[model samples]
Target: MNTAVPLDAQSRRALLQRISDILLRPAPTWLRIDAEGTSAAQLYKNYLIYLAAIPALASFIGMSLVGVGAFGMRLRVPIAAGLVNLLVGYVLTLVMVYVMALIANALAPRFQGRRDMPSALKLVAYGATAGLLAGALGIVPALGMLAAVGGLYSIYLIYLGAPVLMKVPRERAVAYTAVLLLCGAVAGMLVGWLTALATPGAGLGQRGAATLRLPGTDIRIDAHSVGQASRRLQEAQREGDGGAATRAATDAIGAMLGARIDTGQMDQASRQLEQARARGDSEAAAEAAGSMVSAALGGKGLPPLSAQQLRAVTPEQFAGLPRTAIKAETNNVMGMAFTQVDARYSQQRQQVQLRLKDLGAAPALAMGMASWASSTSESEDEREIERSYKKAGVAFREKYRKDGSRSELSILLPTRVVLEASGSLPIDELKQALQPVVQQTTALARPPA
Candidate 1:
């Protein structure tokens, strides 16, 4: 077993550069490796130990500060528990990489490749660069999908490395890569099982976060709110209100990034406002106040509606359904309210959701539905609602009238009205149930108010 000088500074730097090259330029990168005199111990000491630490540290920080955001909610893990999970997962990943290298050696002979143990180690260690570096993505839980995408790219690295490191023929490289991948998968599951056994509480992706709660008014925020604020800030900037624009931009960034974002600038802005007020500078004081309001509440605050506005947004009703079948719907979003009336039923293991949102929220809801309906992947069978209304679409499933099939219908009516009906029902029955509602809603929508 040959080894490089343990304390050589240049070797350490070379290791870091190699990790970067493998991650960024993997296609030609693998062909450049010498793969000579590489051994399991040397690989582990020089590369695996150092490179694998990136994910562990990343996960620890990600879990502690910016936890996962999914299904319209955010979850955070305790720092102590996140640290433990990180350490355990780190050890497991290191072991998994080594085990995959051994598996590569075992599969090499079938592909007519030379039985070189050092080369196999190089293949596994370097091929994992994309996935290893993607650990930093976990810090922003919303970007986890990007990390998964990065991991998928690592498969290509493995494919490219097979021929260079394993000496497999080009035609046999894919097969060799596939078999080794299968082995890695089995090894991963086995290692995970063992890790779970050893650490009872530190299961992968599990965190001790609080239960999901409906966001309170002015408390809960997400990426959408941040984006809205950014647009508002840009508008303010365009209007030459520099102080207001700066305040709006900061609030927007803080909402999207996290509340833990530094507030020193915001504090400074507040101080400037106070100083201006003390000096009897009314214009500066008013500008500062505008900035503070912009930061505190973007776009007139949550739900962006008022009780008077809700009252003015009239409801649409269905004529065929019994009065008993119809119900008024109100969603109290963080104290911001959106009201509508709906008609629904359950039969034959199927359900229907027929809703009419009022003027206040209808246009936005219609836009969202229209966007989904127009998507190429949503459903193949889509068509215009009717000659009367232009901005509407209906997507139907195959055999939609059959017992288990489904369909979705959306129409943007006049006066900012939105009509939506979705269900799994016989196509004839769904049409019958929806026609009267559509007709009534459309009739009301077509006439000028």
Candidate 2:
């Protein structure tokens, strides 16, 4: 609730000095900060704003410009999508700092600490300095994992500050820190989920490469060399040789910033595409186009399927139920295309619905489902049983009622397709009906011929 006051040049220098003191001599600095009269608004306007931008801007450059290397290739997110992510992430981070402060204030009384808003804000904002500064490592995508060390150090900073800022006894600081960390972790996950939803293809640490291509020309920028250079840079850093690490970093940056097109490969591809077009070979032409699209999308998506292809795989009946209705559609958004099919079946009082969706170009959705692939869980009560687990390398979730009046099943295929079945039938029967459809759809997931 505290208001901001105008800060002059001298005040700004003192604020900057606080960062080094907090990092190097946190124990004494916490006492000094506890006595300061700085308001919440001033802390945010002069400190947190700039501190939070470090990670956001670093991530933007890392993903949109520097890119990541995988499978001997370099992949960068399209600049426009990266910009959106940067904005969303930056705003969310600022809010998260404030939320953590609020949590600290609320939990202070339980730990025998005073509930003071300004003190709580100072504890969080200053404690986050190490992690925020370390965000610069993101400028080199492959080294991003190293930033976790900074986060671990930040937890120590908070632990040092808790007794001074919140008036908690030294003995209770550890318990307070653990609870605060658990809350921060949950908030971080929520923020990540929201950011992914806002920017679909802007997921961090995404694999694959994107080639630079002109619309009506054969010119292309191959990033394979850049990818190789980045790997070497990572190795040099790991060896802890300062000179070698600096040189490798420079080499990697130069490779990415320089225009190094492979003329011979470009000419060969152009010739093959021209030949396919001149000969009226539609299949060959389509295949060539599909490859280009895949490269542009970080080498992860399949070409759009035709309406006939989707309809052909959709089942007309399930088990002994008669088909009631069916629908298939392809939707294009932001130059990316995906398909979905829906079908309904019924027999007297029994009914079922099935849906198939392609996740080739939907990286965010695919990443969300991929988390389930490595996890297992199950729970049951008197009326129903629910379980989630991986089978044959595929992720599945199922629930069924004891009376057999309702059941549902969801399967995430390795090919990035999601199949769902729900209705009045038993869960086992629903899974049985989906076997044929799953096989056909998996076959259709291959690249265009």
> Which of the numbered candidates is closest to the native, going by highest TM-score?
2
Candidate 2 local lDDT, 1-449, one digit each (tens): 12235569897787779887786556678999998999988888888887787888898899999897432345888899888977876777678788888888987896689999999989988988877877777788754633543453465577679899999777666556645644454454455567667978433322222221110010111235445765776677568765675466444433432211222233343355556767888677666544433322233445666656777888777877888888787776434576777777888888787777776664433433344444566777789987778889888988899888899888888787888888898777888888998898878854573
The lDDT for every candidate, in the order shown, is 0.52, 0.66
Worst 10 residues of 2 by lDDT: 212-221
Give residue 288's lDDT in candidate 1 (0 to 100).
62
Distance from true location, Cα of 68 in model 2, Å:
1.0
Q: Which stretches of candidate 2 lie over 4 Å from their true place?
A: 1-12, 70-72, 201-449
**TM-score of decoy 1:** 0.44
Error of 2 at 364 (Å): 27
- What tens-digit string does per-residue lDDT give for candidate 1 at 191-276? 65675676675333211111110000011123244346556655765676546654654444433322211233333445666678
- What TM-score do all the candidates reach, one by one? 0.44, 0.45
